[model samples]
Target: MASAAITLAAEAPKLSSANTGFMLIASALVLIMTPGLAFFYGGMVRVKSTLNMLMMSFISMGIVTILWVLYGFSLAFGTNNSLIGWDSDWFGLRKIGLTELWPGYTIPIFVFMIFQMMFAIITPALISGALADRVKFSAWALFVALWLTVVYVPIAHWVWGADGWAFKLGVIDFAGGTAVHINAGAGALGVILVIGKRVGFKKDPMRPHSLPLVMLGAGLLWFGWFGFNAGSWLGNDDGVGALMFVNTQVATAAAMLAWLAYEKIRHGAFTTLGAASGAVAGLVAITPSGGAVSPIGAIAVGAIAGVACAAAVGLKYKFGFDDSLDVVGVHMVGGIIGSLLIGFFATGKGQSTATGVFYGDHSFTQLWKQCAGVGAVLAYSLIASAVLAFLLDKTIGMRVTEDEEISGIDQAEHAETAYDFSGAGGGVVGTAVSALAGAESKKVDA
Candidate 1:
């Protein structure tokens, strides 16, 4: 009996180590999706603000990385509170040093923390795309900092934290259907309402400068998404994780085909933008249900999401609210579609959990639960985002001067240009003059 027990104990450690290693790799894969987002948004904008839009996402990598290490992690995942997390002994990486805390897996708690950190960083950056080319850089930077602290941290705690109310309520968000997509989409609407439309939103053509760039961005996003969905499982289990991976790919492809077909029927030509947008719409929709639904269910979800998001994009024009980049239409609508559809598509085998409406367990209860969850997130995000935007607009001001906006923020704020072909270029000349004046002022002070 003693010899058998010793063998079992030895095997257990190996299994645990394998699980930890898988989680770490999956998390790293998710981190790469942020830069994919940067390229996607960058390609959608005009050349003048291409670099600015990309910078916004890159900056999050820096800001959120630091904040997560400090207290953001504590506020988000520390406790099971409804409102927010209290600073317990676990605050500021205290519990991280204790190896025993990483239960059920071999990897360190620190690895888990960093993996989640990437998601926290990228969500706000996605919202920034909706208000491109108008807001002051300093203000945008400050807004995300404050928003992450007050808004994101609390919501993440409510949804994914250890003792979160949403978790207790059994709300299913395998990835971030509500926490990331709906939250960012609602926040985009709030800020755009306060800042007003770009200078010539309706009047100017504002065509995308490069379709190829958009395609490149889309490819990256799709590639990185495997990590996003499968990584959520945080284990090497072939059952759930493998299902999620296949669902993600199928849905994306289905959405792409649907979008292109719709565009061809409606418009004269099948544009690349339609294909990329459709794929992303499907990806967003599948995120919430990837782990819960079957492959066939994923196809249905993607097809509906693609069509719905395509139609929803036009609402901005009809309603006269400037979403700028269609963040509300794609992310918000797709998220809702996935969240609700999962109710009808969920299934369970012999040892699995609950099944959905279509699996012979036809009932409205699951659908109703999904609706309630969607409504709660929409209401909370809309109100909180509006309040935050209003306060920021009243205090520091949300937009740049009209003249500064027309000139482009790169020149007005940073005093540099994104591209400079001329040797000792115009930007260099301008910088030299400004430096000379600053030196003169310093000499006077001395």
Candidate 2:
């Protein structure tokens, strides 16, 4: 009887295997988003620095992927106190093999580590859009590496880790409204302040080189976002997972329609770029609230995000901050809208229990909490990012020379062009030397 029981137990399907498989697939979906971001930002930049813009995101994947495996995951998810994780014993994922600490499931710790690593990779890359076309690639790389160490890992630990201070404080970030979007948006502002605006900020026409690429990137982002939002469930549950899935779709669609409608009324045309941008804004808005809100709430969130982002994007002209790709407008404003609105919309007892000043909860407790979270994230990210950018600027220099700015970083720094239709014989190395020679000759002529 004992032998027969042991055989049956060995043959039975393991729950951990299923969880691990789902996590790995989800992680893969999320990883695709970095390249998706490449196309998204690439299309928005001038044709001259298209590849350089894309390279910023692509290289983040390479750099952060390695760092996450080495010590990032440990600092983020390791069993340590709240402020920051130590790399003493669990330096290279050594202790992860011994136990599965995440509750309610039995997946390998490595799977969870890899999944979170993807988030760490893309968050900083999102800021690259704001500083596009001017910053030196090497300096940008150094800045992100330091920023992740100083800013991202600690905040992630605070919000998501077991012993995190925010978790203890009951700051409910379902999937990184504060950690990812708010953090990236605030950081973008800091980096832009330090790096300065693009060469022709107000004057350059700076139209998207390819609307199709924008749409494609948007599609990929939308597809990957399902996993991003839904997989936060960390298990196959019908209630929260289903809610997240529906909310993600509703909010995105609503936002897209609202953006197009606004554009038609204001500009007399509904651009494909508007559609894509609206979808992204909606997705960002829904990300923090998808698990907590209902379908109707999602629709409202999406519509508001669409119109709000459209209006907010124009703030660059008014407030005069050159967020080159609308990072502050779409991400910062959209994040605030979603985070605050969720206070009113998260209903219960058929009466909106946690309602904002609107449906009771009149003390505005939830709204205050939401605002506090947003403010904290913004302040921390802004200060930390500014310090890191300053350090990099002082040590390695941030922006390229004005000559390099006009000539394009693809040829000057990377020595390669995004498109080589002219049958240029030289690769990136040759282009760099030629560009440098041109700069020197111009200096001599002057």
Candidate 3:
């Protein structure tokens, strides 16, 4: 997410209690999305892989937090005029004062760092959805550490840093359309190319173990997104934050309805999975465009993203790639849809002065700028992530053994089950009892 305009120069900005309190809340909201992501992903995998899926996302929080404190913040927002940022003062978050405002914003430097850190934490976690059910937990953790350093930090600086090239070129990103969603989505595609598909790709149904959990996670994401989108403006000093807050709701609701409509027409039913996925797709789309478009424009963006992602999710089956939970389909495709549409939908009056292709005088320059931003991130993440995954796969191995996967990755990897069946009928060990109970727990992932 980009910060609100920084007008305060050498005359240091004073802290606003309201903005600080609001930002802290926003930071907390963004942090919760990781666990929300865990539940969302956890419920989508088969019974055997649920715990492993949750752990994949949860581990990112632990890994990225430490990295962010140490040097992730410095590299990502260090205010250097280059592709990467570096600040000696921000090293280990030392040499900065408690009351020191972030450049021109009224919030504390820690508040801004923590908010951005949540984005860092969640970006890598988003890739875990594609790696579900088949990866080694240790290898996956290692990839998160490496990928954050190699891919996320530089791109974050490129897009959001005050001195970064994309920011200088005037590529508009209200939140994280390019930096977070596209980065993770591309990384997901790259990693999956190396790890290959789940054990049974087209043969098994491989449905979700818990739709209720998916719905719960989706709801939590929706609630937290108000802060995620609104807080990007950095303050309620102007009504832009309020506009973003409403756009988030409007776009998400529209996307859900549009997706249900598409599902019913294409598949003849409105499934819970479609609703959950559709909501997330809208959130991804608006993340970049919300600050630049109107409420009506947000509806268009959301509806288009909903239908596009709904259609995109089915592409893996036709193309033969095993995106286990459609991370590429939803996030990658949805992010592209949102980021590019800014060229067409921007009103010239929102966050910045840039005009869209559809506005009066019809400037197509922003569209080209958006392409530059999107293409750079997509190419860098795809290549960098693929290299990282290849190194890990060749050395320590990325996937589990076929025997371990078939038996259950939970026991093979984490040594525990997501849902215990031992007490189902005096014991869930027998084939008949296990099969009956497991049958009741089954649902589809796509």
Global lDDT of each model? 0.79, 0.82, 0.92
Please list the Cα RMSD from the true structure of every candidate, rounded to 1 decimal place: 6.6, 5.7, 4.7
Best by lDDT: 3
Task: Tell me model 3's lDDT, rounded to 2 decimals.
Answer: 0.92
Clashing pairs in 2: 415-428
Give the TM-score comparing model 2 with the true structure, all chains together: 0.88
What's the CA error at residue 288 for candidate 3, in Å? Answer: 0.2
Q: Which ten residues in a row have the lowest lDDT in candidate 3?
A: 1-10
- Each candidate's TM vs. the true structure? 0.89, 0.88, 0.94
Give the residue spans of candidate 3 off by over 4 A.
1-12, 425-446
Q: Per-residue CA lDDT of candidate 2, range 122-232, in tens? A: 899999988878999988888888888889999888777888777666555666788898899999998888777777788877788888888988899899888787777
Model 1 clash number? 2
lDDT string, candidate 1, 409-436, tens digits? 5666667755443334458776786676
After aligning candidate 1 to the native by TM-score, how far in Å is the CA of 98 from where it should be? Answer: 6.1
Give the per-residue Cα lDDT of candidate 1 at 261. 80
